[model samples]
Target: MKINIPNPMFKIRAAAAILKAAVIPSNLRFPGRALVFLDMVRAATSEMAADVGNGTKSDVLMTPVTWLQDAIIEAPIVALDPEGDPIEGSELIALLETPNPFYSLEVLLAGTTLSLAIDGNAYWIVNHGRGGEKLPAEILYAPHMNMEPEWPANDPKKFITHYEYATKGQPQLIRPFGIDADDENAGVPGNVEKGLSVIHFRKGIDPDNIRKGLSPLKGLLREIWTDDAAASFTAALLKNSGVPGVVISPTDSEVNMTPEEGDAAKAKIETQFGGTNRGKPIVMLGPTKVEQFGFSPAQMDLSALRNVSEERVTAALHIHAAVVGFGAGLQSSKVGATMESMVRQSWYSGVIPLQKIIAGEVTRTLAPALGAASAEFDNKGVQALRENEDLKAARIGRLYRDGVLTRADARSALNFETVDADNVYLSNLATTFIPQGQAAPPPSNGNGADPKGILARLQDPAESLTNLLKAHGFASPAAMLAQLGLVDPGEV
Candidate 1:
């Protein structure tokens, strides 16, 4: 006997096999294009505004808050349709389609879900009622003028005529919706109409449909149903869905689950409910306790977990206590003091009050200049003048006496007087070609510097010879070193 078996996807009458489940279309719908397009507008405007604010350009004042809110309001209408046309009735259509941070957005006509016009924010909130639904209708004006302080406060004068023409007054539409429709939000100004941004839902939609469509993805996305029958079943659920697209909000996602946490959660599903979905909720991809330790996610029925043991559901409570504890302690540490608090510390008493640390630095740096001033000018007051030119000359002369501030020194100090005389000079060879200079002036023994005694211990071999040579007035370090008889060939 020859027996024939029907293939899984063969729906007898329709004779159609949906072999593969279609992709869950992205929220933006068209692959990466929607997001890319969205970003271009956001970034282009954001960048231009940021550039203006950052001083890369001028005459523009852009606060990021204003920019972000505007972007949210403007992004959808400006997005282009695939054929290079601006989307039809763009404003209203795009609003419904465009997502917000928290939920789906749409310019709902008060109570009903029927889409309104995008042609112009040309909205007429007409009172509407059909079947059992009724909504109050009103005329809602869109952003009207393209110029002046109409949109930008500063540029008010830029389009005096345009703003004057458009903004005669904000008026409330005598009727909000068609006779049976409900006016969702109260209206403008003191009337039943107002110009306000609102976020909410349409009334009278099937609760079950909302649950199936607007509801979060009930199970983890798992199991590519390869068998044609199973694939077709999955496809049918999506194909028949009331909502044209899937729109998920961050809130809808399960508190993120670890694989182990998920596995333990899922293993108990069968015992709590029948092996197949008929016993409880039948969500696509099946209820999942997806193993989050980097394995493929499993579709899980969390309702099943309502009866499952807590042992399968574990999450960290104390594992990070140490890190948070350390951060809290650090936040209170002394280094956390504000700059003003640190700067004012010298006015108070404490262990090297932070201000002392700073003042000590100032004094330490200014010591040479101050001390030299005291020595040459003979007093601390600014009015004091150098009593003796030789003393003044000595200070300037001592600048070189220590060593003529070398080029790198002058450039670094910006002037010889303020330069720390102890800086290592190209002339660091000291007595090698010159007389035993007053033991190269001692260094301030402060901070963590290596003790300055190293200079005291070193005596140049050429110091005595140079002194004898200098007695003959060889004049300069270079001239003395270059003299034929002065430097021995061996030394060279």
Candidate 2:
């Protein structure tokens, strides 16, 4: 054999090809597929922009979203200690009070909530102090549409290496928490060394792309489109004097015209009868007849269709139609739903859960950076989140009377501060306590009573018997009393 050896350059080329295949994702390997994927992303982004734009214009979409945003903004941000209790007068609270120079905490919270509702993602840029300070100096809100996460080459375990923030100028590269400005693996070339990090708050995971969040509006896109189309149709009808369309033709079939004549007739009819000329009384000759085409507003039943679409949209956003004062929700209110109950339901199902997610994310990311154990949105100040005071007081009173909770615990449950006397359990004057295995005292006799002449006490015969049995050996007097039916079991 002539010692046929493979060329070194060929071996190098083969190894390079294998390495490239392994390192680059398959979608990126083919230029056509990559372009297709890019187009898909562009389409998705356009859809998201349209959803948010249209949502802002439509009351059906914006009502619930604004309600939620207002609720979130009204709540205060609290820093927590290691024991999960709110830390009083912490630096974290001070920083949060004025998160940045341009906006207040409320504006930040409102923007974040609105973004989560619209884009399903919110981003915050944390600018750490230049003098080696652990806490951030300023927190800047980044629009979700402009922020994107980047990952290293084919690294599944390292899902995100850094965040790429697109600006009007050059795009800024922000490292995640733990990566310093000087870190070798901070990100791609031209990564800024300004010690910036990003905090991403996503509504939930996207099944299609685990790296991204799925917008709540995704499923309701068709419904939104339908609502918009219906609105446009209704507006058009109103503009046309409540008429959908009209057909202008000769009443007699014998009155056929040339194509040029037909075009001229159509132009003349539009000039005099369209838009502002609607219902101006068309002047026709030669037995011409005008017939209305398309469905009228009544025939379309636009109200019912819009109401249904509104209900679906509100439901997807975790808000009842009644809470948003939509027709469908108002109809339900006529049946049984109350505004208060609907508001509470919205808080429980929509606002609180969203607050928890945002708070939990803050606790995980911003709190530790600021040397705090946790950070949470305090809804205690929000009236909508509060329980009915009357019902709460009654429940607490019942629990206190039963000796299940101390005065301090009950007060705490009601969001009241405790006093020194609050450590004791509440004692009911009506309750007569008997020691274990001891007999209850007999009812007082009227003989030799005090000069005040207090009435003699009388005890239920069943109670006396039950007390006697308890003194002897019976385990539960309440059970025995229930069987006898002499005393109310609840009272016992």
Candidate 3:
């Protein structure tokens, strides 16, 4: 019998094919089937983010999602070098500033965040570098509807290793992949038979459900829709319902008409006074008494009801209504400041976590390729951290002068990377003085000028006069006068 040998390449391709066949038609399971339940959010017939892209279904109709998108994209991100310092003027920053031909860094991040917020997953397909290395040259975001994750039920702790990109008319390809545990680089998009170089950022993780991420506003979307319906109903009621007024009622002395005559008279009456003319003056015949019913729109508090709905939608999106110049707080400057503070808090609490996630993914995946130690997306300007830079510097300076902190410590505290501290100096007099048993302190020049002639230029007469006493070895003009026991002619 001829010996049959197994080819390694054939085995790998065969395994990949088998995996792809198993995963392609398989239906993934979610924890709450929340997306399905959220179908009624946009309307009774409208699709949810699960079917379309996140926030896309309601984007044209809802102000909250659009306003949130604006806020999310308003901030720029900083790229960090391996030494935990910002990499200014780097190619990576350029790439991030313009992730692709169609979108800027802010736009890309905003889209990613919207995806995370709506669908609970963001797919980022990274194009390879010119050298065929797995570095990302361009990143394209894929909607959750376009991506199909193959999560094996047997393994709960494991991440998805196989996915199918189901684009219209594109050939279906199966891929094998795994996240780099040590480096935590999960974004690698390619044929699994070769390797995965694409990143899938999944939020709201749990052991029970690996494929689906928990969306925080899933239920709130439905509630918002409900509130919208209520507001609409209230509006329609006010618009269509005539103000409380009455049609004239006939007294018992009047004779009843035949059914046909009564229907004719009813139609005639409604034609004259049913809708628009309900509140208008009526020219009544003798003893045609009038009575009214129902309350006015103001009495029903329609405006307050609408305002409550707006407030709820704003809160769910983690944004202030006043930020968009809409709410009651928009008119006053004090309220405007409150809105600004709210924005800062929202950025720190919501956007910062999302930023950290993106930064972590970028650092782990791109650092090695970029030859940097690590990378990060900075949010200093977005969070208004730069405004306090002067205050932080002052605090760090005080601590350093007190000898309780070092130059490196001060730098670290002020968010700067460490550097050589050998040449660093403290200007505190306490630190400058010699110890009690050591040599005496150096004599002062009786002026604030540098002893090493650093400021010896004396740019003007004012500068020269300021240094005159120091150059003459007098502590002050007053001290010299006291020694002489008399004032100078100028002083007199």
lDDT of 1 by residue, 274-332 (tens): 34543585343434332222211133222223212111110011111111222222243
Pick by TM-score: 1 or 3, better one: 3
| Per-residue accuracy of model 2 over 309-373 as CA lDDT, tens digit each | 88888887899888777888887686542778888788878887778777766765666656666
What TM-score does candidate 1 get on C-alpha atoms?
0.14
The regions of model 2 sitting more than 4 angstroms off are 1-59, 129-134, 185-190, 241-296, 335-337, 405-492
Q: Rank the candidates by lDDT, best first.
A: 2, 3, 1
**Which is the better candidate, 1 or 3, if ranked by lDDT?**
3
Highest TM-score against the true fold, candidate: 2
The TM-scores, one per candidate, come to 0.14, 0.66, 0.56
TM-score of decoy 3: 0.56
- Location of the lowest summed lDDT over 10 successive residues in candidate 1: 312-321
Candidate 3, 1-492: lDDT as tens digits = 001112323433443454344334344333421244443444542543333334454422256555556655655555544344556687667777777888777777767777766666777766664433455577777776677666444543334655677778973443322243122222223444232345667666634355656555654555455555565676676666635655555665666657797688678778887778775665755465566776676676555545555666566556566654544335443564566676676665555566656655554455445554444544444554344567678988898777677666887887788745322434432234456889764565423345633245354445664365556555676745533434432452
In order, the Cα lDDT scores of the candidates are 0.26, 0.69, 0.55
How high is the lDDT of residue 338 in model 1?
Answer: 40
Q: What C-alpha lDDT, on a 0 to 100 scale, does residue 353 get in candidate 3? A: 60
When sorted by TM-score, best at the front, the candidate numbers are 2, 3, 1
Please estimate how well model 3 matches the true structure, expressed as its whole-model Cα lDDT. 0.55
